[model samples]
Target: MSFTLPTPTAAERNRLARLFAQIASDAGTRVMEVYESNFETRTKADYSPVSDADERAEEVILARLEQDLPGIPVLAEERASREGVGGQIWDAFILVDPVDGTKEFIQRKGDFTVNIALICGGYTVAGAVFAPARREMYLGGGAAEVFEGFLPGETVTQGQKLVTRAYPPEGLTAITSASHLDERTKAFLAARKIAGQTAIGSSLKFCWVAAGKADVYPRWGPTMEWDTAAGHAVLNAAGGVVTQPDGAPFVYGKGGEGFRNGPFIAWGREPV
Candidate 1:
């Protein structure tokens, strides 16, 4: 129930990022292989869909995290649900969403991603998201400023550093969840002055905003801590912000809500 927290030194952070990127990329590959095959989907207790890909990918990532990081605790989506980690508090831990955007993955939308993050002091220190179907991977936070490129491997370098563009002078460009869009989101956009919008699935919205492809992503519906932690870190590393409606920084470790997130906005710039 207790362990020494890893020091967040620069070298240590880089090592962690490399290990995490490899894990994410491997997990993503597993997901894509499943995507290419005839996969079955089953409904979970929460009525959300789960597939063989989710379990297989999480098992791969979890085993690596456990073997490599030893004492560091991990709060992965599939395992945590059965282990009840969502209801416990930890000073530092790894949060993993082995497959985000399951609905998109099931639908073959190619919007799903494999997410892994290090959360310390209620903030994500580093994170990585790999979209195998899209052949793209993003890593950010801590010593690694946000970056995007193919997943790190034998040939590719780390990646190009990512920076969110300045709020467009013309107007704001927003991206919303392709499948989860609701009236509240539309109303939020209507009330605000925005020029255009894009609908994409999964945590890719956060990556788009972080990569300067969009300005803001407002989510008024429910999400879990695992759903946003990795993407939140990527956005933050690229000079973006994710905050509650009241504009406070969105921190994790929400044991009270069982790690479920309330509505929040991921902005390319600090909201005025």
Candidate 2:
């Protein structure tokens, strides 16, 4: 017997977006609780940092997801690295980064976020990202339109619609990582004649670009699928594009490649 994936109806997609917003918000609250306390931090095997907030927030997210959407496989950052996700030919699955900026969280910077994305057919169908510290959340993809605001307890219908701005003729405004800026990134900006650059943390860069607050985000460093999926969905819905340096569409479900993402550029508007 062969198994098949069920396609989500429009109503289901809208409902799923709301559920994802709630779940990501719940995870963000857990992170914020740890952020306010004397939390312990440690280095992972990959030399990247992980804090109590990361683990605890993921726990909260996984628990709720399991309860609310049973049988759906979840590829979460901490859990997937610890216990490998089984090789199931899933047509739909959840990708989550419970705490996307552990370093920023540890440093008391309000730039960390909680991310939840639903990938089906190798594309992000629905997603929600919450920055509890900033009281901002972004939701989009699938049947939902891109939107952002105080969205933890609110639905997409209540949030403000987001759209990308036109590319300015003077130069481009770029957002980059606050802690992980590499020379390649600097060179990319220099070559593009960037008008300005802002250093930020987590998937907020993608959200800012989606909301027309910024013009572009160029990432030259390595990243995981969970690190960008949710934001990618939001940006994609907001009239933006995330593509490789060669202008190929950024895609997901690269389990064969260890779910690693190559360098990509997210554009607020099509660039010449």
Best by lDDT: 1
Residue 83 CA error for candidate 2 (Å)?
1.3
- My TM-score estimates for the predictions, one after another, are 0.92, 0.89
Candidate 1 local lDDT, residue 229: 85
TM-score of 2: 0.89
lDDT per residue for candidate 1 within 156-230, as digits (tens), equals 256778888999878999999887888888888998879899999889899999898999999997798889988
Q: Write the per-residue lDDT of candidate 2 for residues 1-272, one digit (tens) a residue.
A: 01234556545655676678888777776787788899888888778889888898899889988898888889999988687655445688899999998788888988989999888877776788888888888877543344434634443345667788898778888999887789888888888877878879999999999887789999989899999998887887788889998898888888777888999999997854
Model 2 — which ten-residue stretch has the worst lDDT? 1-10
Cα lDDT of all candidates, in order? Answer: 0.82, 0.81
lDDT of 2 at 69: 84
